[model samples]
Target: MHYVKSKSILSAKNGMNLYRGCTHGCIYCDSRSKIYNMNHEFEDVEVKENALELLKKELIKRPKAMIGTGAMTDPYIPAEKHLKFVRNSLELIYRYGFGFTCITKSDLVLRDLDLLEKINEKSKVVVQMTLTTADDELCSILEPNVCPTSRRFEVLKMLDEAGIATVVWLCPILPYINDTEENINSILDYCIEANVHGVLCFGMGLTLRDGNREYFYEKLDEHFPGLKARYIKEFGNDYSIPSHDEKRLMEIFKYRTSKAGILNDTNEIMSYLSEFPQKSVQSKLF
Candidate 1:
């Protein structure tokens, strides 16, 4: 890991990535795509040394809104166990009376449950987790460096019991690998049991671009020999490789989420994540 001074923190939308690159080793990571243009290795992990200071300053100046992270890199990556950047950022968000949300694949997020709960009470906090495959073995193969789906389910349950809202990103389902009725159903069952507020699924297939495409094909060759050749034959260099089963899989997704009363519309979920709580507004007014 290396630290670099950051000129600023929050995005125009109040999102910030305190770290760059990742060590999660997820084979389908889009962050590795060349379009992002990272000068360092994907595993090197560039730390924004002044992120917390900048965040505190920005929080004081900007009108209250939800502060988000973990978009480009998982904030709870293994490095977080020692660095505590995410945890410190959470403290600032809570202290400054801003809502918070993040997308992560690590159970390490549970370490900051106390602060998350506090933020929830004061404003709002939504914990969004990505669950692509329900099978633990496949999860290991797809997201090797992160916690398994079973453990993530437990984390979701814990968050539910703590009165924190949760959301799941069930996506990037690799075709001919995990794109199956059984796999989708199993993950949906977990979302139902966890009482997640929503499930965001763009489609049943994953996107492969320049940098990530080569890396994904290499991993496919290593683990599922001959798969890369099949991908090239089938997909060529297309960006969006929709699953042959996309229509059927999306039907299932809509059916399950609708029946469970969870928000399935992408626009609706994004709105929920950005909306600050009415209670927070009233408290501030008084």
Candidate 2:
């Protein structure tokens, strides 16, 4: 881990990433794409040493709104267990009466469950987790470093029971590997069982660009041999690689999620995430 003074903390949309790069070692991470221009090693884990200070200043001046993180990097990376940057940031968010949301794959988030619940009671908090496959064994290979799909399901259930809204990012469904109906049904079952507010699926495919494309192919050669060549033959430099059975798979995704009353529209789900409870803000005036 390394620390560096950052000029700003929050983005124009009120998003922030206390850390840059990652270590989860997901075989297909978009953040690794060269387009981002990250200078350090992907796993070196750059810490924004002054993020909390800047966030506090920004929250003090800005109107009460949702404060988001973990867009480009998981806020609950292993370093967070000791650094407590995310935990401290949560304290600041709660103190200033701001809504909170994040995307992560770590059970470490449970450690901050109290803060999440407190923030939800005062305002709103949404937790988004990425579930690529329902099989823990496949999950171990696809997202080797982070907790498996089962554990993430458990976390989602816990969050729902706590009255905190939850969402699932059912994405990057590797074509031949996890694009089966059985896999999709199993994962959707978890979402329905957990009673998530939404399930974000932009079709049933994954994107691969320069940096991540190379890395993903390397992992394929290492683990699924001959698969790399197959990917090359099937998708030559294509950015969007859709699963062969995307139409059918998407039919099931929409049907099941809609039947369960879960939000399936990307724009609507995003609106829900960004919309802070105006009543909560009004209550603070008195």
Candidate 3:
């Protein structure tokens, strides 16, 4: 891992990525895309030096607090286990009494569940887990290095049962791959079973760009064989790879989440995430 000095700690949208590259080694990782201009290797994690310190300083300066991270890279990458930067960052969020949230594929977040609970109790904390495949072995092929989907569902369920809300990023359903309607319904079923607050899926398809595109095609040749040729024949250089079953899967997602009373659309889910609860406003104000 390497260290770099970042000019700012938060994005315009209130999100922060404490690291540049990821170590989880998700074979289909979009962070590998060259567009992000990550100077270092994909696995060579870049630590934002003094990220917690910067976060503390930023929190002190901000008149209104709404901080989040783990969008580009998993904040709880294995490096976090040793550096404890993410944990310390969460502690600072809790100390400053700001809302906290993160997106992670690792169960490592469980280590900080206690802190998460405290934040949720006092303010807000939402955890987002990506569930692409229900089959464990296939999950190994797609994500490769992260925890299995089952465990992620378990974490989601556990969070919901604990009264802490959760959201699922049901995404990257690679065409000619894991894009079956059955797979979508199964994941949506899990979200319903977990009683999650929402499901964020713009569409039942995958978007491939320059860097991640080549990596994904290569992996396809290795794992599914002949699939890369199919992708080329179908998608060419086009970005979106909508599955043949997109419409059906989306209908299922809508029906399932609607019945479960879970927010199913991207707009709704994002609004829920970005919304600062009136309760927090009232308490923090007076």
lDDT of each: 0.95, 0.94, 0.84
Q: Per-residue CA lDDT of candidate 2, range 91-110, in tens?
A: 99999999999999999999
Q: List where candidate 1 sits over 4 angstroms from the true fold.
A: 280-286
lDDT of 1 at 42: 94
Clashes of each: 0, 0, 0
Candidate 2, after superposition: displacement of residue 214 in Å?
A: 0.6
**Which is better, 1 or 3, measured by lDDT?**
1
The local lDDT score (0 to 100) that residue 241 gets in candidate 3 is: 85
Residues 25-130 of candidate 3 have per-residue lDDT tens digits of 6767888888999778899988889777778888887745556787899888888888888888889888888888788888998999999999888788889888
Q: Report the alpha-carbon TM-score of model 3 versus the true structure.
A: 0.95
TM-score of model 1 relative to the true fold? 0.97
Candidate 3 off by > 4 Å: 280-286
Model 1 lDDT, residue 175, Cα: 92
